[model samples]
Target: MDVLYSLLDVHIQQLNPIIQDKTFTNTLNFILTTSTDDIVSITTPILDRFCINILPTIDHNIKSLILESKSMERILLAADYPSLTKLKLFNFKDNIVSYYFTDESSFRRIFREQITDLILIYDKNNDITVQREYRNGIHEYIMKFFHNLKYLSINGPSSHLILDDSSPTTCFSSILTKLCVYVYCFQDCLTLLDGRLKQLTTFIVEIDHSEPSSIAHNMNNLPNLTTFSIEYRCNTTEFDIQVLPLLRRMSNLEELTLIIYNENRTRLVDGTYIHNQILLHLQRLYKFNFYIRTCTDLNNVTYSLSSDNIQQTFTNIGYRHVKCILYNITRMVICHAFSLPFISNHLEYLGNTFPSIVFTRVTKLLVFDILPFEHEFFIRLARFFPFLKDLSVMNLHPQLCKSDSVNYDHNQQYPVIEYPYLDSLHLEDSYIDYVEQFINETKIRLPRLKILEVDYRKLNTITKQFTRDVTRLNCAKVHRLIMEKQVVFPKTFYVYFPLLESASSYSYYFKK
Candidate 1:
């Protein structure tokens, strides 16, 4: 028998059994090094038990600790962690910031010499007005305390916290190698990386559109940087020109990811030029991911490039290592926007004007915001991507119904569109009739098909009833079925399919 232990949500009742078992106790001593929870405060009973009984036994084994502001002092004082090298502090309050850095505090001695990796997360729930000031003060104070700190992560709403250049307390450790923070401007990011963090190799920052040109100029200062990522929220095409030049400066970058929420209308010509430029410039880049998001209604949208245009654009540039997808944003009850992956390589031919392009090597595809009316468009996708294995479609317009006039028998006379390697299919908020027909038609073509996931949140009462009725007739060779909600199936389903068991209310798996 194998047993796994987790420190999350641990119950006091469960502790007695583990304490009694000598083998389990030994395992606990080895495993319970890191406190891995975002708990605001530890209850007195749990705290007392941990300090008096638990910490002393496993102190030496602890290599890392993650604690909330309220419980950090009590837990650290419980026992000496000689092996502790990494510490993460969360939900920090302004009042307790000075205590930990003071000479009289126990943490000063423990962290001053040994700690190398430190993560400080500000409480997001706190008043936003004061959080900024608190974060800056805490960051400045803690930086002075850790003499050998190499890796630091300051996570909060914004990475705008800037250290005073003239502050006598400013201690930029030469040993620091990696930094992750959210910056308000590009200059502040450069200030930290320019000369202060000379040894920094990995830097991740979130910046606004304030100073795009400055990035390319200042990036050269951090010659040691190997991996760099910038996330910016902009709705314009002007940033593209600014970004490409920046990429050219980072010749040392091995991995790069750009996430932009593009609000401005983009044309195919501009997109094509940018795509080609990245490939031409980033010669040493091993891994690159580009996420461009736009807000537009599916009812009236024009793709800048067609599938053929996208394929030809990349082909023209002699680049085939990228994949582009168009998503249909659906407004859900809980979330503002829920997007479904839609229109992979062949989306160019989908008659929509949205520019879609992807590498020929891509096997998995996600398409979103497809009109339920287009049945042939969906079927033709499999024929385009012969290598497609997994496909997920979301936010399908609900009005479109499967054509009852078309005879499957007559259709069988023609050459069937096939995806021989296709394995997994996922549909979200789409019409069930069309899905059933698509699956039934493609069953033989998809021999490797194993999983089918359907989200029927938008299915009407009549459509849902029709769906349940057609399940037996629409049966495909899929091994697993995952639904958004629990479904009541016909008794015949179980009789015909004995191997299938309900793994959960929303999931059904084949036992075999």
Candidate 2:
């Protein structure tokens, strides 16, 4: 209903004159279709009045093609009406048309400067028989006409846009800052744009996937660019030496996104080693995201591994190397490596406290998949990172289920005992037994515990022993008890009335 109203609103002005007029007001509703032949004859005067602009089709069979006075100038005059802000042409060929209109003296004499946004969409319903020379001419004229244009979009056929080393270039120094190009045009346009579009800060390019590195290599030289997104539908192995370095050089760049498709079985030279060498040099890149196209299906790359093969293939990628390098990082997201197989080993390595003690600077750990060693390892890991605050656990392994689980060190009687300064905890899809154990352990430890979030899907083993133990505890400092599913209530509950704020699924802690 909302969509229908919005669609009708676009033609509201046209509809108003027809609806209010005494002559055609009797026709409450009408259906308009393009298949009919004599629309001009059948169309009511009211409807005709509203038909201010006819977006002529490029189809050869369409009878209502825009053919005003058989000349380009006359056609421009015919289409250039106060109500018509858009003009679309198809199967349009020849460069002479634009050259004749856009000569400095010619444009001043004829057009008198009225056009702002110009669009030329081709290759949709036409063949190569279209005039190539005319197409080039049209491009030249349009660029010159729209010097102050803010938005320009071009989508053309791959064949028509092939560029030669000597291809003509356009200058856009007249403050055309925001530009988006989703063209199938030739790659030489990149070189032509050199030092021309200086004011452009925001750019978006969706390239033809047929040829891989052509677009990427050309885009590397864009100077003073801050925000960029380039998407390819097919995959190619060419690294486009310019892309990586250009990304590193964009000191003012805040947001960047790249979507690469892998259509061909092309193997990329492992550039992680190169990235590692260059990381130290990229002083401005405080945040970085790197993704690769290993397959055609997006999901294939997303959830690439199952639990069975996770651990074995964990250490192969540059994840370990990169993680090691960026150990000091606080906020980071590495997508492809989110599965159980990849993360378990990294966690285990951090958790291990053996012959030699290695420290992890990570304070807030967010683990996705549950591993068998998480429950046991975190107990030891907390000892090392004494100032750790947030511990968020998502999918836990069934094997980590223990009866009375607590943050207990098996070697408590040993020489050294390290205690972590944990404040907030988030447990999802955790067993009831583990939850009870966690709460019991926190009774004696975590004196500064402020929030506890528990999402227990299966509460099979929330026995009386667990409830009794929880009731016996005095966690006076704990303020929030957030429950998603029902909690098996302990024998007796201490309701800290004044201190407790709210018990809800979603919680917020604002950072000043």
Candidate 3:
């Protein structure tokens, strides 16, 4: 007979090490299935020594024995375990319609003392919440036993669980400090009394679109909180920013992540500016992340420069100076208002009008974008931000012409115009023909060239011949040829592709 000692979940059978050694007992979580008899037969004495988890007598009965015994069959049980800490039950397909607390009292009597962190996952089949009278009796039994429990997780809809005024009295008083719930409505938050949440440190709420105010109000209530996340994507309505003053009250807050959908109105009111100013008042907040659908929401904001200038209004401020500036220029629409100028143009203005802006503060600038094929504005863009260490360019658009110039090469005979101290260059695009001349020219000039990523666009016989000629030159330190729609390598056109780990369109090849 094999004596097995292990911590096991039957779902991940491949990764689990089979119990071959019996020298030491192990902490175990044995998930009971139809093959449990075989498991018990293989490892009995080893399991008795270790911390093992199995369905209690009543839970085991529901798993086996399909016949519905409705004549009020009672079972007797007894257990004594000291090392148990975490317990979870997912009795979705158990068909627990007829099992009452009085009948399953033997199983409850054993579990009520040992279990600490309990997670119960309820689904359609064994949904106790649907049976009101039976669920209430079961909850009463559970609350009485697991009084010392700290972490509690209840999954499923709120409509399933019946909560009256006395529900909190039975369960939510002395023990629980961390609570995570998936249900909606302010009713869940309002129901949790202040006494129960006084010692609470972390609370995560996954609320639906219908209850934004409830999420906001709960954020206000948790004064002892350190981390908070609210996901309200489906909700069409905007959360009232009036809650900012209340949120400012959370003095101990360290991290906050707010993900909100786009609002219908573009023009933000002056009151919104009032709330934006409140962020500076937060003395403890070191890290902040705001992800809104529109940049138009950032319009209008005031800040304090010093005690001397209390009347001064400032729109944006970065606490610590950032060395690199990343420009993401996709899906941005501006119809000629008092909008900011193009980044390269803005940099030029800051350098000329405010000469102190360049060569002193920022060290590097990385621009990765697909400029419109029709416009040749990149020549003008290359002039600004003269002190860049790493320059990365990605052309996302499909079509491009060879004559379109984004000049980086400066001739020795020309006027003294300092080139950017560009140490690394990363280029990726489908239009390699358009950038062929630029690549050939810059490869010889850029002495500090180290890394490159090139994705070739789909082409016919003529274009493939052109690509082979470029490949044979073998100019780049890391050159990769990506033939989209197929993997057709050119004959004897060997080029070193140190970085060609995999291609993007892999599955498309198999389909063809």
Candidate 4:
């Protein structure tokens, strides 16, 4: 009903003035004035019509306006938006930016006092000179006119621009609470924040170089800062030296996210000593996220274990609290040497060097990015993690399902391995037959399992068949099945399994 009314509102606005009635105008006015409503987008033609024909009567009713750069000036000048307080500008060009900041511009007269939240977006072009100019002009424009501006976002090429014009003595009226900008302008932004935005509580910055030490030094100035994020791209050695020490000073930080890139994969294999040192200082920290990426040679690489004597190399060190998902052989060796507790790797890798001390405490596990092996390999892997609750496996071979030569009934004679606490399972890019075989043959029932997510884009024609088979299974414990693709079940199937239908109290649908 709301969608229908909104559609009617759009069509009525498009009608000719002679055809527009009082009821239509009233409905349009109600939509414009409603503070709870969001006017998401407005095209050039609609904006022009509103400014020329309708705005004169309902100018004071509008609370927010989102305009494109092309029509921003014309729209602002059409009427005096007395109640407007929020404005967002898109595709803002260099010339238009400069024009609006000038003293003579009519836009400054109407919106300068009321607009507290402002957003400016520019095209990300390869031309460095144009970007620099736009950044300088836009920064100057904001500082001059929008003295009361509280929330501001300047995205794109402005990150590379250095604000040489801003001085330490300049005072700004706005007390910015949140800021997102690039590393190049970080120092200048701090200079601006020194006296102006002293109350800022959140800061998100992107670092593209190896100067994390300098960034850390600047962060001390933001004493009131509670949330800090650093998206760093550099080598692992540099991160260890420059980035780790920086974490020690952020005592007031409540949440932290570090996205680190490693050019040298060998450096991370040493263990979590550096990470542990950093974690020790964050006493007030409640949320901590660490993401690492390393360069890999995709063309010529073999994941096969070289020796059976690998288990003799591990020494039980005190680095048991660290948990990680290792990608290759070097990382696996590194984890073993450090005695890291949790691991997510291939069945082949685990079979060759299964460490008892490390596997006993692992609660989360993922077997990903490996060649397919038999179902027996998975059964062996599950035995290692006694407290395992979450499991995600990808790319298993389909032969495990069709291997009738080996009797699973004999395998079932062994004690059934049940993960009592395992509530969530995710399988991606695997054969449907293998999945069915694992569920049926293993006879492993997760009584506490509530969520099951599967990705079957690899199975095209038999996707629905797989869905049907899963729904018909004895999965009484499962409540929600989240699939990558949508599935439709037959009405008779739902009718026959009325208890399953009652158990799942909601309709199954794709989550966008």
Candidate 5:
């Protein structure tokens, strides 16, 4: 509960009198929430006070708890909540699940008999992990554990959650009515849609890769499912085999959401393609939200297709707040279109081609551009997305026009890019010039910047071996410094980032 703690700390002096009020202190549900902020831990004192003074007082009133694995044990053991039914567990690992969820764990009764809604959110794991075998056994254990579970969701950082559990035991969830999950492949996704959950209504999934299996594909469709959504993170070319065919079977869907982006020169997922291939087949559908981006080679375009042509298609469908941009640059016809306001909290791939609207809701953004992201583009971004907390830039080129951006001598050339709410800045896949553009106090001002991911050599060189005076202000507040490789720096490095609590290097993190 980083936001809670921060609010309490910020207003503690004024709120001490109010905090002492019996009415205020008696409401302990605020203490039961997991932190939405990047800083993912609660202080020991906060935990101790919560367990000792607060939880027991309002134990019966508690109905739900959202907790990270680190503090989950202490909080769960704090009080007996007679009314508790829902749980959203984050940062879960296999070992942690085995210790607490397998066999005779203390939470066995609560999980098996009490909880009806469960959300297990794990950290990104490429390897098959979680409660013995994530690929084979985790879903089985989940279905087996929660007896009265009506809604169950399992999420991961990436689409590669990798669940290979096609066991007949998991094939049926009699009590489950809703499921939201991520799978490694389409076969695993088809396993979920294989007409096992007779009561299942809402099914949301994000799959990494798609490989059609005739046996799984030919299995019965989800006729009971009224709500359905599918998202693709990978550049998919299998709409005919993977996506559309699956949709043709789910004819009972009432609400549908699709977020798809494809780079392959397959059919461009425009209005006509979506209508004929997808929506036309789903006769029972009423509500729809979509964000479809297609990047096709210019050489492949046969007919006249312009931004106006694409815009009219969306307009015909009565999508009022839709934003569509067509960029004919770098020998690729890149079309970005999405219905607003943007629903996803973490937008996947954004670039220089952006709409001039405030995406106040989006917390995480990935900026990828073959062309350089100059100072103006950054300024436009910071100005529009005022509440952006996480930004990952993956541009490989340096700023093309620096004269309009950088102040060489004394004249302030451009307005400094500021991210007042940003906590995480990832420049690990970007050029060193971008490193300099951000770290240099003159070009950008990151007041709330805490997490920074950069190349070790680039960081060192740009910071002038950690003694650069110009970059000190921007580097001063970085709490977690992520690098390509582990390297112990001089005393100046620590001095440069005085608030840096930790430094780490992950070769795997850079592979993204």
Candidate 6:
């Protein structure tokens, strides 16, 4: 019975952790069966054993179930969970709503009667925006379907559940106390605060686009809301107009996190501006974490502003560990500022000019520059960001001192540039040399690399149409591969990438 404590909150993947490690592996059956007429071709003997031999023995004690779309029904039928109250669904889409949430389903009664917390991971949104999954259908239904839904989280950037004035009141949830989801438009964030979900106390939203939103004139302060966080990926120039008004409404918030990305010279989200405009207003706020990257074009600026100008702004502010760096390339100044130890697990647009600091916490890093990423830079990166798990190299320019060329002439040489823990690498927007730097076994080693995103052109050029043995070690380990160009599944591709299960074509976008 002591083992039942761990089983109180059951994640289906726990039974088959090795097999269902990747995103493609977990939802592979669901993607295949739903997209085509094929049944689930994959077998799960462990899951069968859990259901047949284990679940019935401890069903009454189970309080939570986190499941995926394909085997959720089988797992539910195997047990009558008397104490189940929390349900987190992965790979949840519009097509499966009827399969699980409707009256036709056997577990529908238990879902509506027992579940109070629901987390729907749409599973496709790796970036900020995704379109393949359900946008509004599943969200609108769950608000009414769950009789006691207190905490509702819809993961993914496109899970924007927006309702206009014509929307029915049934879509509104008075029982919901915490809501974390994405919004399509800036107005949708405002729409959430428009007397809907009257009991929502903690709100975390990611606004994909900052379009022109009609400002709510008499917006009431969110007194009940103690937690409010936003990640506005507005590449457009509307951060000031669209974001500031929304923050003013959360005057009573206790915890606040703002990760805003945009380009602006004058209207910067620097420490001084944040202190004067934001922190001063939120009197109840005790905790705040922020990562604000605002690019400034010095071409049109009348006055000069260096990294010193921005870093000095944090001197008076209470934020002691805040670091600011301005990467000046040509006429464009990339202002990257954040409160350390790293706000999120990711950092972007970093270059050779970045300050020497140990970012032990940042697991995902994006290195963007027109200048060639030299071998020394990689050595420096491996030393500073020791635990980088996912790395994105976005340089169209090739490396000057290529990995093979490094220490060819000089006696002083850098140690092997090894990312021992890196699981994913993205060279989709980079050159063939970078592909060589990481994949070529002689150059560097990525022991845990499983996912590779590259351009077909560079990949083909480097690996010589997937015939090179130099990259076979990494290509063999990569389970999922993403190429900018559509790839023909030639025998060579398969020969090179033996462990490949998923390969898709995608275009990687960087800021203008």
Report clashes for each candidate as comma-separated counts: 16, 8, 0, 0, 2, 0
lDDT for each candidate structure: 0.54, 0.40, 0.36, 0.50, 0.73, 0.72
TM-score of each: 0.53, 0.37, 0.39, 0.48, 0.81, 0.79
lDDT of 1 by residue, 294-322 (tens): 44344344544333454455455544544
Residue-level lDDT for 470 in candidate 6? 59
- C-alpha displacement of 275 in model 4, angstroms? 5.7
Best of the two (3, 4) by lDDT: 4
Q: Residue 74 error for model 1, in Å?
A: 1.3
- Provide the lowest-lDDT 10-residue window in model 2: 325-334
What's the TM for model 4? 0.48
Best by lDDT: 5
Candidate 4: C-alpha RMSD to true structure equals: 15.2
Error of model 6, residue 374, in angstroms: 1.5
lDDT of 2 at 465: 35
Which is the better candidate, 1 or 5, if ranked by TM-score?
5
The true-versus-predicted C-alpha distance at residue 391 of model 4, in Å, is 28
Q: Model 2, 210-316: lDDT tens per residue?
A: 44233333344454666665554443333343344545555566556544433332332223433453444444444344333332223323333332232233345
**RMSD of candidates 1 onward, in order:** 12.8, 21.1, 16.3, 15.2, 5.6, 7.4
List model 4 lDDT by residue over 1-512, tens digit each: 12222343366666434333443432232112112122323555665567666666555666666666666767678878777767767665567656776667776655567777776665433344443455444554565577666666666544343555455434344466666655453345444445566776776666545532243223454467688776665564666655565566567879876655555444332233433566567778776554444443433234442222222222122333433433454333322222242222211223223344436654555554444545555566667776666666655546434433123333443344466666656654455644544344244556566556654343222233334343334344556555665556555534433434223222232110
Question: Which pairs of residues collide in model 3?
Answer: none
Worst window of 10 by summed lDDT in candidate 4: 29-38
lDDT by residue for model 6 (111-150), tens: 8889898888765523434354444535778878889899
